[model samples]
Target: MKRIEPLSAARRGVPRWLRRALGPVLLIALWHLVSITGVLPQEVLAGPSVVLTSAAKLVATGELQQAMWVSLGRALAGLAIGGTIGVSLAVLSGLSRLGEDLIDATVQMLRTVPNVALIPLLIIWLGIGEAPKIALIALGTAFPLYLNVYAGIRNVDASLIEAGRTLNLSRSAMIRHIILPGALPSALVGLRYSLGIAWLALVFGEQINATAGIGYLMANAREFFQTDVIVVCLAVYAFLGLAVDFIVRTLERIFLSWRPAFSGT
Candidate 1:
């Protein structure tokens, strides 16, 4: 009799839950081993226990909460501004060739330049304060929103537009009835993507000019060899990302309830 392959059997027969659990189990074990071995510098990367202790200290003092609020506020404000402007421009561009040509090249050029490269110029212009940080966040988020919205609008089914025209629907009515729904799913995807970039930009901004917030905490800790504080900062950053993503997922479900595929998942 031919021998069956062990690898194929494991791959096919193992439960997904077990597979997922195994990854984290292996990662934690590796992390524990690395911490014990001192391969990575203790100052740069503390073990789990040190991170947790730092977290507890920051929590009791309310420093953690304040940093979260500062970072979150910046990100949310940028999202609102960028999302609104991107959607508005996308609508205009979709309706008119003149708008499309005018808006397209300029946005494309701006998107190519890294946001961090603009920091020096921003500091010179807006000063080393909140304005530059907020502006950076907005800049980071705007392009993704703009690109996704514009693409979604442009790719709206030609047949649908023709059908609306055949039925003698006005331009506004056709856009409202047909175009909006088709394009909205993509817009939602862009919104989620932009929010992630906004968080990253906000963290980078804080690391530079700010005296407070998690990024600043990390930056300062690095200067003083306080690895535990650095670990706390990273934990806070990761936790916030998870919390924001959960909120976005919830919003996606509620707002896009009409999407049957998502509902099934």
Candidate 2:
């Protein structure tokens, strides 16, 4: 008789995307189970069903849609400003010792201070309008990208530089062909990190005496003890983060197609 394989040893037939989705599915199931069983009180944490209902109500009222648009606009604006500053500084500092000496020290010092802590100063400087909020998001995102891109540039293989030298490639050509491509992977990683931080910054930024956004919804919910609404807002933040992350991952797959790396099958 043929020996039977254990279940764990059986070849997996599940699609990769389905497998990836299983984790969230299982967690939601467990959450729903605990919620209905009263393992956690609704006051402490609302059930997924309640949260879903709350989300639906917000959607029907168009409140959620408006808030989402506002939040997305702020996050995108901040990202654009921050990404430009981060990449420009990284390229400058990474390419030349003099530039590094001038900029890196200041960046290193500033990054150690929490971006949120600057809210008071930022409010004083830029006022309670959108300026402070956008500036805060930009501040939070810049450091991660700068660090990664700078490292990527500095870490390009010495042999590649030697090869470029042998080819008599000019400074600009060498950077364009060898250095920048080598740094692309790291820069992509920085982008992913920056995107995550941008959402986080948005969370804090929106809470600053704001009249709109998901954070504003949560803040209002807090005053009324509307746990379900708060939970819905929290879920919105999570979903937004996941959506942006998916976009970045898609970009990576497209840009890094030439780079061979082991897929953890």
Candidate 3:
């Protein structure tokens, strides 16, 4: 006869989404408690309610929407430009020994230097305008995608290459049909990383003579000690990051539907 399982051994009844939400909920509750008790002063950091109100005000005044659009444009432009350069260089370096010898070492050296450290030089070269900001973001985003794409190309299954060889596939056909598909998952991961880096780079870039954008708003708020407004800008940044991450996840699901792995149940 089968034995009954103990209650302690049963799976959780909580929904997956609810379980995920619980942690943030608990944190917010604890924060509210401390805030109401005056353990956390508003001068240092505004409480959640104040931050929410500030966000609403910004939204109503249309300032937040205008700022968001400007920031989004910069981030997307940088991502597009950087992604193209990264993919081209990765393809070159990964495919030919001569290309690797010429390009890889130089890229590796440059990658060692922090992108943020180049801000002053970028400003000197490109000026304290949108040009410098977009260039900085592009520079910051390129390396991650380049590295991942190169690795992915080099790591494509040898057996698959042999199979293509047996089929007498042309070089172009082999790359188009076999190598690119094999490398795509890694490229997607790199894209995700690059997207994150783009946002970070934008934050730094916007701090330099920016007339608009979330970074500008935050900087302006700091002058008046508007902690609530600062927090609102921070939250906007976070929400945008999360939104882009979710988009990437959706792309992975669409493109990698054939690949399967253990889901940590």
Candidate 4:
């Protein structure tokens, strides 16, 4: 049998941050080369420089700021609503087999359904206002949270539960001290997943009759054939997703510090 070193061990000489950035650095270099080579029409696929220039213009005019705030508000609002419901249901299901049996089947069914597919029905029921958009984001975010949270809770070590019972800890005390802490890592994983889906859902929701949002900006730019503006909108979406992931990762490092596996060291 051949021996294979772990990637971290194999790359021990490389700085972790530099290694992490290698792919993106290469991708950008390739993009710049393609743009300079004129292999792709500039009008059809604007380069990073052109997109950055357009972003600067939009920022100077405050159009990007206004659209971003509206989109941010919608995303956050949906996340709050969906997150609350998800955590509550997950806790309920975690606390009892009866609760799990009652709620899990419906969640599993709905989780399989695409949130984007609900747009038409949501629009019909909630009208073309912010309600449908928020609803769509909520639907998209809820399932990831539920699945991860339920799994985290259910997977808590049985030995820990027995130890808590030996210590004669009350139900609430056991849950608070043992289960939630054990599940924190998985729950944070769910949070990261949900954040990504929230943005995806927001994009889908805003595409439908949106007057303000990154999606709306992209839609308007398409009408005027402004490739640069379209590229700017996509760049903004990418940046936002990265930002959300960073925040959640930071939270994990902080909250899961007690666990050596997750510690910042």
Candidate 5:
């Protein structure tokens, strides 16, 4: 009888990176096959190969890089502004009932209104300038981050806080040593969500009277019926969102290393 290999041993032969890429590889293969099969019209949906070619051409011309940089700047600026405000508000509210009463209700009410809906008013007030676009991204990113950070702080163990008190820790010391560390995991979770929302907001905000950015490129492509260009812009958006999420995950691994939950990584 032929010797049977252990599953774990067999799996060890596959590179981890390859395993991670398997899903996307399969997806691209399926997409290519579908394109060749003509299940959808080429005008409606360009194949992965066509998108790749379009992306290469755009890159060679430096158009994609310039557009990407413009979009990236908008997204990052919005994220920085929104994240700062979110964390600040969350810290205040999480630390005191008075702050919660003052800030939480207004934030909650505003949360009910979609950020995209604010575009019209933003345009009217801020015009088609970069201000409205950045503001829209900020508005879209803030609430999720605020909610997450607040929840994380609130969810920190009472036992930990009490233990800090037992050690005669000062209020500020307790927050710095215990509360912040305990709340970090949740905050990172919020960061990941906020990054996703920032990208989404960028996509929406950039479409409005945009002269430079991935969304503008997509809009321009749509006007001329350049399906491949539109697809390339979409791929860039997807990649940027994924890249930000990966960065957040890296931060989590670095900061959350003390936790038992992350010991495996």
Candidate 6:
């Protein structure tokens, strides 16, 4: 059996920053070495230097910023729509047996259906507009939130619930005071874990008859064999994901200050 460490008592070293940075610094050095040694064809896999120059060009022309804004807007729009619906339905499902049985099976079935597989049908129905793209990201984001919230609500300790009941708390009062607070951490985790999938769904969604966006830029570059542009687009993807995840982690730290385990345990 795999051993599990108890996070409640575990703590990381204060100077862990250096250790954390070492892996990425080594990876970058290795990449530079491989490029210099001609381990890979330059035309297919351009050097980091070329990618940096292409990125500079894009930034100078404001193309990078424009594409970044469009992608971010789409992702946030979808997030708003999906997060609202997920939390609402999750609360309903957890509160009532009828709601749980009705929505749970349908959600499972939809989740099993690959989001990419819906692209063609979405393009046909929504016509490659913002509607289709937003819909795709929403679909990708919803299930995770639903699963996390439902699990979180269901797992709240019975003792705490009984205490609330003994205090003569109303059903709504218990949910608001005890259940939601208990479930908030897991729901936040779901949101944090979802940043990558939301970004990916936006990329794929933009691919359908796309006119603008970094994904479009990257795909168009592939046609002319511009590996540097492809690399730059991918770098943007990496940077954007990193920036968003950092923000989420910071938010988690602020809201979950009571949870010592999340503080590098």
Best by lDDT: 2
TM-score of 5: 0.93
The lowest-lDDT stretch of 10 consecutive residues in candidate 3 is 5-14
lDDT of 5 by residue, 1-265 (tens): 9999766666587788898899999999998898989986788899988889989999999999999999999999999999999999999998899999999999999989989899999999999989999999888888888998899899999999999999999999998999888888888998888899999999899988999999999998989999999989988999999888888889988988778672222
Model 2 bad stretches (over 4 Å): 1-10
Return the TM-score for candidate 3, rounded to 2 decimals.
Answer: 0.94
Better structure of 2 and 6 per lDDT: 2
Better of 1 and 5 by lDDT: 5
Residue pairs in steric clash, candidate 4?
none
- Lowest lDDT sum, 10 consecutive residues, model 6, at 6-15
lDDT per prediction? 0.83, 0.93, 0.92, 0.90, 0.91, 0.85
Error of 5 at 217 (Å): 0.6
95-118: candidate 3 lDDT, tens digit per residue: 999999999999999999999899
Tens digit per residue, CA lDDT, model 1, 179-226? 988898788888888888988898788866697777877788888999
- Spell out the clash pairs found in candidate 2: none
* Per-residue C-alpha lDDT of model 6 across residues 62-109, encoded as one tens digit per residue: 998998888888888888888888878888898789999999888878
Q: How much is the lDDT of residue 24 in candidate 6?
A: 85
Candidate 1 lands at a TM-score of 0.86
Residue 233: error of model 6 in Å? 1.2
**Compared with the true structure, what per-residue lDDT tens digits does model 2 show for residues 1-265?**
9999756546667777898999999999999999999998888989999989989999999999999989989998999999999999999999999999999999999999999899999999999999999999999889999999999999999999999999999999999999999999999999999989999999999988898998899899999999999888888888888999999999999989999987654
lDDT for predicted candidate 6 compared with the true structure: 0.85
- Sorted by lDDT (best first), the order is 2, 3, 5, 4, 6, 1
